[model samples]
Target: MRTEMFVDGKWIGATGGTFASVDPATGEVLAELPEATEAEVNAAVDAAARAFESAEWAGMLPAARAHVLLKAADLLAARTAEFAQLETRDQGQPLAISAGFSVPNAVEHFRYYAGWVTKITGITAPLSVPNVDYRTRREPLGVCALITPWNFPLMILVWKLAPALATGNTVVIKPAEQTPLTTLLLAEVLAEAGVPAGVVNIVTGGPEVGKALVRHPKVAKISFTGSTAVGREIASEAGRALKKVSLELGGKAPSIIDADADLDEAIEGNLMSGLLNSGQVCAAATRFYVDRKRADEFASKVAAIAGSMKLGSGLDETSQLGPLVSLEQLEQVDRYVQIGRSEGADLLTGGSRADGDLANGFFYRPTVFGNVTQNMRIAREEIFGPVLAVLPYDDADDLASRANDTDYGLAAYIWSRDIGTANRLAHQVKAGTVWINMPPLLDAGAAWGGMKASGMGREMGWAAIEDFTEVKSIWTSLA
Candidate 1:
């Protein structure tokens, strides 16, 4: 299928050129999408700005906005399978994961945020002067720019777009060029659900489309999810324009397996958590911390489960793991494995590509490495593969220190039987999201974001909805 850019509530051919999205499985062209130019990006932003400034939208009550948002949510939930299949083909995430996990997560974000469309509240302040009465009212931030990554395209798209729209702000989204099909399709869902034209739009392309949107004067705020390097560029541009920015960047998250933890349960969670989506997830648990006594046992179990995982096409009924997003990513993962071996980390299991039998697809065997130190290149950097680095620790304090040593802290996992210890360690770790015995993604109402180099700003929940809105103080005098 050929896809086009959404501008001013209509799908039109790109003025610049056309680009093809390839299926990572066999390197076949899945679809052709527009290479949006500077002009097209600016046009989408201008349309969103005009929509925001219009009395038709700006003057409407919160209830009216809520009605539209909820309607969109219902339509999205009904069409979950269609979006999930497209996502699996384009992004290389398993159809089961995309359908059972990502699509539903996206729909929840819409339905939950839909409820908040009319409930935005502001506080009343005590006045110093008796002649004046002051109160606050929340208003939309006009135009918002959303730039989502290739991994979990539909889910991350919801994370960026839901609150921006639910709070009554108009938005122009720039989904990753590699996998923008689901998002461009989502624009149709919004219209079908009753969201007005110009309220939402999708522009897809590489760096230029992203750069143009970020630097545009019409875009009041930007919310992005991608690599740390690209996030830096976007943040710098936003700084230059004095525009608001929210970023959910990269991570090399660590999971600690305490001595008092359930070894079997921990091993199971560790194996499946990172292997989900073939470990392309930003918050994927890549590093495993265990007591010295349990390191050997833990490594064996992790390797066994990983070795047994069914690897094939995302659409395969028995496939639990899928290919990486691209052949480029497969090469990157292999290079990192080589780096680990050269750095003296023991290759416990899976050190090569699975191209022997799966020659037609981009497939790498699930990898596990042992005898890893905190200082190794493999442990420190993000491999973005189905690779695990199991590190041994002597004490809890030492484990905590080592876990915090990484430059990225988007998410962390703790597998322990003791509630007190889990709660205590959870407080010490420097991550936006900390999981205790659970490695799955969270609900739509919880605030999800990262700290440090992982980027800033929170999305979801009541507070996150407010992130898309601006509060104004109104003062009146009654003489």
Candidate 2:
């Protein structure tokens, strides 16, 4: 079978060159994907532009669009096992995470957005002219460029595609070079759902393809999810083109545990948000701040839980924490442990890679550092691993200030049973979303994005559809 780029209802090799998709876990070849050239990206954008301009999708009723999306969601749900297995093998995410979490949530996103397709409406203007009436319209942008990350490929793709398609825009998505197969699989399901040709296409490659999509004149909007470094570049280039863009970038989220919080529930949120998907998650709670008096207990509890998780192949049901997405990622996580030690943070437990039967893959011990200060490297920068650094603070004001110190404002977590205090803290935290008493739980219709460099604009919800669309006012005066 061809493991090439998907363009305009067909799969083919790259015009310029080819690249290999390596299984980051075993360091083996998964498939040979096309290294799409600038010309190829331009071509895909052109196809999308043509489809959009011709209104191949434009004239379709919103209910019709919703029907197709719902059908695709159903198809994906039925093929859940297949996509889950592929996601596990390629990205090294736990099979349970892929199968039980990301995959199911992906389907949910599609189904949710599908319902919104017909529900999105524009209001009639209250006319000042006696005989003249005015109206507003929400129109889909002509074409969009979607760029996804390796960490939650299926979920992120759905986040991009659902709103774009629901709003009646065509798209040319560039899947991350590391994990492209599941996206290709999605293309198959989209076609089976009766989406029109050229309405949605995907190209696989590295920087060149992404560059092409961002700069292509035919593309109207670009929605990207990746590291902040790359996101900055996309925003810069897209700015030059004067195109619409939405980015969901990097995050170094914090989970603050106060004196009055439920210790058990807070620990559960910390682990789930930090260690799920091997800490490859963007909003993973990497930094933990606790009350000074309870700091020791919190640190010990977290360490115990981190040490107890099973590490093995994602396919193994017993495995809770899977391999890091790549060897480089594993090394990066380990390096942070070293950094934490060097920076004078107390190494309570788990400061090395997991040994024994799990040593074959890129597995690292889920490390924890106590007495971590805000200035410490691990607490400030995004480690993007299963390592959690615990810091202690005396008061709410200090904790709030420390939490908002970083440039990232993607998401933050606060744990306390005091709803009033939690609400006040949530208001002060510099983030797009703050979850109190919980972590990383996204409602299907909730708006998701970041402040500062974490990213611009937002995704999910009917409000997010506004990002993929354009608003125009129409007036007719009998003057």
Candidate 3:
């Protein structure tokens, strides 16, 4: 693995101290990596700014830029297995998920954005003024600072990186400290794919490094995916500087099961969407609202499925669920589980940490709580773990209100056999993305973000292009 930080197309040792990258599955040190200092962060931003203005990058043809992204995508596809293994080792997600979902998704983002490179165009508008020409040019925002979380490091990084680069913006990335291995490796792939020097840089550190990058004057934009609290801080700093910012933050997404919904399908959808990656996803279906008459059955079925999940190391092929990202995360999940009990929600199954062979790792059993109320902490706050809180609702008339009660509005799932009812409820929900009769499915071609406190901007599809670029209106007098 590459241990040093990538800056200006070169591997440099950090001025800041080194930190150990621990394997959450075995509590073993995978690598001791360098943490970039404030000085180093400035260097990265300076490099990115220079690259953004350089002829080798900024002046290159759009087709050439697309070629670089496509080549990078091809290289990533070739090394998918290697990347998947490193992701599983570094991030503690199941190997199957790393291989099947995250790595593949990263490749697709590059390819998808590559296709957009040549297609990005300016618009000529007809104005009422005579002897004048009016047009709007979509231009890159220069250097972008991408601060990604540990849960889906590679995928989310590309969610920001692909579009930024597609629009001709150079970037400096700060991968979550806990899982920087795969991102460091990607620097090599981009270099091999002929990305110009200084166009992409990476610094590995915690919040201090992130704060420095966000506050850097040369950094024209900031794209962040993490907690809502941190997002607020970044937004505040960026607002003061007038820097463009897009955040994909925390979520407490709710899944609703209508009275006429298919019970078995709803149960399966909840298990897959809510408990995937042990529910560490920002858009995981943490809250479930079911018809009161069938609530008991839905909760029971969910508990039974969650109880059967195999918790072990990500490298273990037979393992169905992996450990939480770290010990701190494990404790946080446990605290919420305790809060659920205190709030009088019924703990249906798997409420404690896994023991035996998985005892040393940060493994929490998939937990489910029934009879959860909207006011309860477990139902409202983002647990960000494999803890599900199922709430029973009496009236369909007010179901939309009950579901939209949370501060988060990132993503929601609705299950109903009647397409009309599902469509109606989908329109009523406040979430940015609503899935009907399905689990959480994300596409590179579709926009993804939140409606309220969940976040301020979208991350995928054409929406990403808008986030990474700025419009410049050019008016010419012909008379």
Candidate 4:
């Protein structure tokens, strides 16, 4: 893997020194990556800004821009296995997931946005004033700083990068310090795909680099995916500079298992959605609200399924779940597990970290807490781990209200045989995305974001194009 930062289309070493990129599955240092200081961050933004204003990129036709993205998609698809392995190694997700979901999704984002490049349009307005021709133009925002989280490193990077590039905006990306390898690899892919020099720049580091990127005056927009606390800070800083910002932040998504729901399907769906990527997803269904009548049975099956999951190295094809991103994450998840116990929630199956053969890695057992109240921290806070808090709901009428009680409203899941009831609850829920009788599946065409503290703006589909571009009104005298 490339250890240096990619700035202005050139690879350079960092002045801030290097840090070890440890593999979470084995607690092994995979590579040492250069940490970007403020100097490097500024250099990246400067490159992006210069590229944004350059004739090579800025003057390219929509079709030509789309070609670059499509070529990148083809290149990525051809190297799926290579990218997936690196993603699994860097991010601690199972190789199956990296290959099946993450890498494929990244490819789809590129292709999807490539299609949208020519479709981005503004309307000509029929004005009240006579002899005046009025129209609006949707234009690129220029020099976007895309900050992605450790959980879904390469996929989420493409989530922001695809749209920014589709809208003709240059970007400076800051992948999470824990998982920077795949992003670095993608820089090579973008460059090889004929993306102009400096059109896409990458600087890898910790929070200090992110702060510098956000504070850079040349950055016209900021697209972030991570914790809500950090999102709030970025929003505040971007607001001060009056830069456009889109944040896909933390989520405490609730999954509702209604009385009439198919029990088998609901249990399996919950297991997959709640435990996928070891429950590191931002829109993960961490909170489950079951009808009181079936709560006991539902919790039992979920606990059994979670317990049956195999914890091993992400490179192992048979491993259903892998380790947390780091020891720090593992400790945080365990701390929340303890908090759940103190709040009187019952630990149904696994609670502590994994032992025996997996002792060296940062693996936490897939845990489910029963008898969890709405007031419990596990049910309220965003615990980005493979831990589920199942809460019982006494009435169907109160289900939506109870699920919406948390500060997060990113995504929610509802399982019901009755479409009317499912649709009703889906409408009642305040989250940005809601699924009925299905596991959490994302599409490149669907709008993904949140309500309330979860986030500020959407990331996928046309909404993403809007977020990355600006609208300008123009009036011409026809008389």
Candidate 5:
């Protein structure tokens, strides 16, 4: 295992010694990762800065850069199974999910952004002054710092890196301490694909390392995906430094089930949407707003479906739900379940950790709560686990009001047979992305992000490329 910092084209051991990477599924010590110190982080940022100024990286043609990204995608596809196993072992996601969704999506991001390499455009404008000519172009921001969360480490990392590199920006990545293994492995993928040394650097450590990256004077932009609290901190630091940034942060996303909605489809969607990845997903539908007429029915069905989900090792295909990413995450979910009960929300099912064969893992069975109110802590907070809060609404106006009540606006879902109602509600809902009769559908070409306290800026698509580039206008006398 590569348990060292990848800086300046080479892997070096951390000066701060090593830290253990435990398998969330079995609580076994999987590997010892080097705890990169502040010095190593600085080295990474400096390396990226140097690479951004180098001809080999910064001056590479767009088509040539695309070739490198495309090669990386091919290499990733070839090793999908190997990387998927590593992801499951480190991130506690099901092997099938890691292979089918996470790994492949990482590859897709690279390929999709690869197409954009030669397509990044410039604009020619008609100048107000007859004697003057003006043209606008986008240029790379050197030395971007990417901070990714543990839940979807590889995929989200690629989400930021693809566009940053495609736009010609060098980067320093700080993967979450819990799941830095696969990201460390990505260095090998990039190397074999012929990405120049210092173009992509990775530093693995705790929050101190992240803080250093965000505040580094050499870093030109910050792209972070994690909690709102942490995102805010990074944004504040970036603001002080006058650096560009993109944040994909927390979500208390709500799913609405109208009276005319497909109950079975909503139930199934909830299983995949709310409880998928053990509800560690930032965009997972944690808040449910069902029409009063079908609230009890919806709540009961959710409880039953959540209860039936099998919990075990991610490597086991039979296991529908894997363990929480860590013991700390497991405890957090348990605490929220208790808070839901204490706050008078009906605990329809599951409020404890799994036992027996699954006891060794950080596994918690899916939990569902009914009669949830907007005011309750369980409803208001981002639990980041497989706990659902189901609330009822009597009217359309009330449903809209309640759904838009929270400070978060990352994503929202609506299920209804009435296309008119769904369309209108989708427009009214306060979120970056809205899904109608769907389950959190995401694409590399579509922008993904949040509003309000959720986060700032966007990721994915051509919009993501815009964040990493600075627009410059050239003016000259033509007469």
Candidate 6:
């Protein structure tokens, strides 16, 4: 495995030194990775700025840039298994999920955005006056700095990279310290695919590197994905720099099952939506709102699924759930499960740490808490684990009010056969994305973001292309 920073078209060792990258499953040190310094961060920004000004890159045709991205996508598709193994080993995501979802989704993001490169344009306006002409041009925003979280490291990095590159902007990305392997590998792939040197740079380090990157005078835009606490700091620094910033922060998404919903489908959706990726997803459904009439049934069925889910090393094919990203995260989940019990919520199933063969790993069982109130910490906080809290509501109004009670508004789900009820709930819930009769799903063509304190701005689709580009209007006399 490569264990150096990529900058200015070459692999270089970090002056700030290196840190051990531990495998969450085995608690074994996988590699010693470079710890980037503020000096290195500045160098990356300078390189990107220089690249953005270079004739070879800045003057390249939009179609040519798109071709590079498509080629990169093809290269990644050819080695999906290699990338998947790295992800499962480093991040503790199940091998099947790493191969099936993370790697494929990363490939799809590049391919999807490739088609938009030439299509990114501004429109011409018709002027009423005879001698007046008006038109708009969309242009890249120079160098962009991207900070991606560890939960979905490879996929999230591509989410930011694909759009930035498609819009013709050079980038300096800092991957999360916990999971930088796949991202470093991606830089190699981009290089092989003919991405111009300095066009894409990777700096691996802790928060100091991220802070330096965001505060660098040369970076024109900042797109971040992580906790709201960190996002707030990023926004503050960006605001001080007068830089454009887009954030996709944390979420405590509520999944509601109405009276007329299909019980089996709801149970299945609840398990996957709340428990997928070991519930490390930012938009994972952590809070469950069910009809009072079906509350007990919903709790019992979900509990059964939670109790039976296989917990082992991500490399094991029979394992459905893997360990948390780290021991710290695993401990955090355990504390929250205890908090739920202390708050008078019923522990339906699976709250303790895994034992026997799984004890060596950072594994926690899929946990379910019944008799939960809207105000409970487990119901309100972003657990970031395979823990589900079930709360009952009497009517539509009650369900809507309870669902909208949290500070988070990233994603929400509505499960009802009745179209009218589902439509109304979809409108009432204060999340950026709302799904009806389905688990939360994301398409590259649709915009994804959050509402309220969850985050500001959007990612994916044409919206992201617009996010990376700035619009300028031109007026002329045509007499």
Q: Top model by lDDT, which number?
A: 3
146 Cα displacement, candidate 2 (Å): 0.3
lDDT of candidate 1 at residue 213, scale 0 to 100: 88
Question: Which residue pairs show collisions in model 5?
Answer: none
lDDT of model 5 at residue 274?
A: 91
Clashes of each: 0, 0, 0, 0, 0, 0
Against the true structure, what is every candidate's RMSD? 1.3, 1.4, 0.8, 0.9, 0.9, 1.0
**Tens-digit lDDT string for candidate 4 (418-459):** 999999999999999999999989999999999999998898
- Which residue runs of candidate 1 sit more than 4 Å off their true CA positions? none
**Cα lDDT of model 3 by residue, 240-294, tens digit:** 9999999888999889899999999989988899989989998899889999999
- What does the lDDT come to for candidate 6? 0.91
CA lDDT, candidate 4, residue 450: 93
Whole-model lDDT for model 5 versus the true structure? 0.91
Write model 6 residue lDDT over 1-479, tens digit each, in one string. 77899998999996878988889998899999999988889889988999999956657888898899999999999999999999999999998899989989989999999999888878998978788789999989999999999998999999999999988899999999989999999998999998999999999999999999888888999999999999999999999889999999999999989889999998888788888899999889888888888999999989987898888888899999999999999999999999998999999999998988778889999999898998899999888999999898876677788888988999999999999999999999999999888877778999999998889999999999889999999999887
Candidate 5 lDDT, 390-443, residue by residue in tens: 898877777777888888999999999999999999999999999999887778
Residue 226 Cα positional deviation in candidate 4, in Å, after optimal superposition: 0.4
Which runs of model 2 end up more than 4 angstroms from their true locations?
Answer: 127-131
List model 2 lDDT by residue over 1-479, tens digit each: 23877777777676777888767667678888888887778778877887888887867987888889999999999999999999988888878888988889999999999888887777787776786778888999988999999998888999889889988999999988888889988988999998998899888888878887888888889999999999999999989889998999999998989889898899988999988887888898989889999889999999998888888888888888878877778888888889989999998777887767766678887888889998999999988988888999987778888999998999999999889889988999999999988768877789999999899999988767899888889888756
Predictions in order: lDDT? 0.87, 0.87, 0.92, 0.92, 0.91, 0.91
TM-score of model 1 (CA atoms): 0.98
Please identify model 3 stretches exceeding 4 Å from their true place: none
**Candidate 1 overall lDDT versus native:** 0.87
Q: What is the clash tally of candidate 6?
A: 0
Q: How far is candidate 5 from the true structure (C-alpha RMSD, Å)?
A: 0.9
